[model samples]
Target: MSVRAAELPSRDALQQLVRAKAGTAKVHHLVPVHPALAPLLPDGGLRPGAAYSVTGGALLLTLLAEPSAAGSWCGVVGVPELGAEAARSAGVALDRIALVPQPGERWLSVVAALAEVLPVVAVRPAGRVRDADAARLAARLRERSCVLLVCGDWPRVEARLAVDEARWEGLGEGHGYLSGRDVVVSVATRSTATPRHVRLVLPDATGRLSAKAPGTGPVELRAVG
Candidate 1:
């Protein structure tokens, strides 16, 4: 029995269905991250339509590689210190990256606009965000299914990822130039239960991130409710 084309659902109908089911994991689209860092994330990837507060400027920006590589648009606002070279080195598609070097007082507005279209938006607030503004941005992210990657302090975030005790692997006794860095990355969440940590190279000796061999490096895991 062949079904008529008219019986098929319209694009708008499909979109509405996705939005209605967005809150559930089944409907939500997850973007993959570096395998080494996957163990730290709740579902081992980036969940769209949620906000994540992360520490470490470079490490925070590096999270976009997965989505960017998957042909998604990424926007970086109010983070002048993050260089394009670093983002590229971390496997981000430079052409797909939209950068607003200094968003100043309009950082929130810029993020809101980008979230409407981009799949991922990373921001480093120049100053404190009012509760009202935060709420509005959060709502926008939910509606548009955009991932908000924050690089600084944000109140009432869905999850918080921080890199701690980072130790450089090279340049001991002022002999060699900078090489790689090992850090303890901890991820904790409030919206969903994700309590785990991992020790990995932010960038190994060859400038690529990978998990440290077990028993060869220190490990620390924090228990959370």
Candidate 2:
């Protein structure tokens, strides 16, 4: 049998009901986009069944591979500009990732349908993502235990993670093979509590993003213009 969470007395009660109904569970470790975001999340990870907004859709899609590195199903919709090389840099295993080619109003429908099978679904909230649609999507995600990562400006999501341009001070690379060396990027996010932010040196290796350095101070990142 199934029960609506709205009817539960409280969140704790709902959790208990879910736990009892859903038998044993296995722990899945979460890889935070940055160390600064670790504490913001209850278990140093993205909470399942909620929405996380990435400031830049491209960057967000790349970073998403971190948590789902264990062969989990990931879906991206309404984004056709994704590059294979960029996907590699963001640590996504392109071979396993599904890129659904949907445009216009069909994107939202694709997102809703794909969420049933994909563990983590990322999308650009540009076309067809209305407030009512977001509400329905959130409910479906919660019911299905699918994590929805929205990459754009959407006000109805459960949480928001915004990224800004990286700050580099006194860092230089000579005109050689080291031209792309030592670049840093910073991202800031707002939650129910205080705002959280962090900066990290871009990963030297392709197809991966390093976890934030522990106890590192956050550099202020204003929105990208």
lDDT of each: 0.79, 0.61
Candidate 2: which stretches are off by over 4 Å? 1-37, 168-191, 203-207, 211-225
Give per-residue CA lDDT, model 2, range 1-225, as digits (tens).
Answer: 999977769988779888766533412534344453465454466656767766654447545666556677788887788776767666677877888756576787788898887778888865545788888988887667777787676656655665455433333343223212232233334544655554544443343444445222334456997
RMSD of each: 10.0, 9.0
Models 1 onward score TM values of 0.80, 0.68
Cα lDDT of model 1 by residue, 1-225, tens digit: 999999999999999888777546534487667777776776667777778888886676578887888899999998877867777887789999999998888888999999999988999888988888888888898788888999887776767888887887556453566667878888888755655788878876655566865223333346979
lDDT of 2: 0.61
Q: What range of 10 consecutive residues in model 1 has the weakest lDDT sum? A: 213-222
Residue 110's C-alpha lDDT in candidate 2?
Answer: 84
Worst 10 residues of 2 by lDDT: 175-184
Q: Best-fitting candidate, measured by lDDT?
A: 1
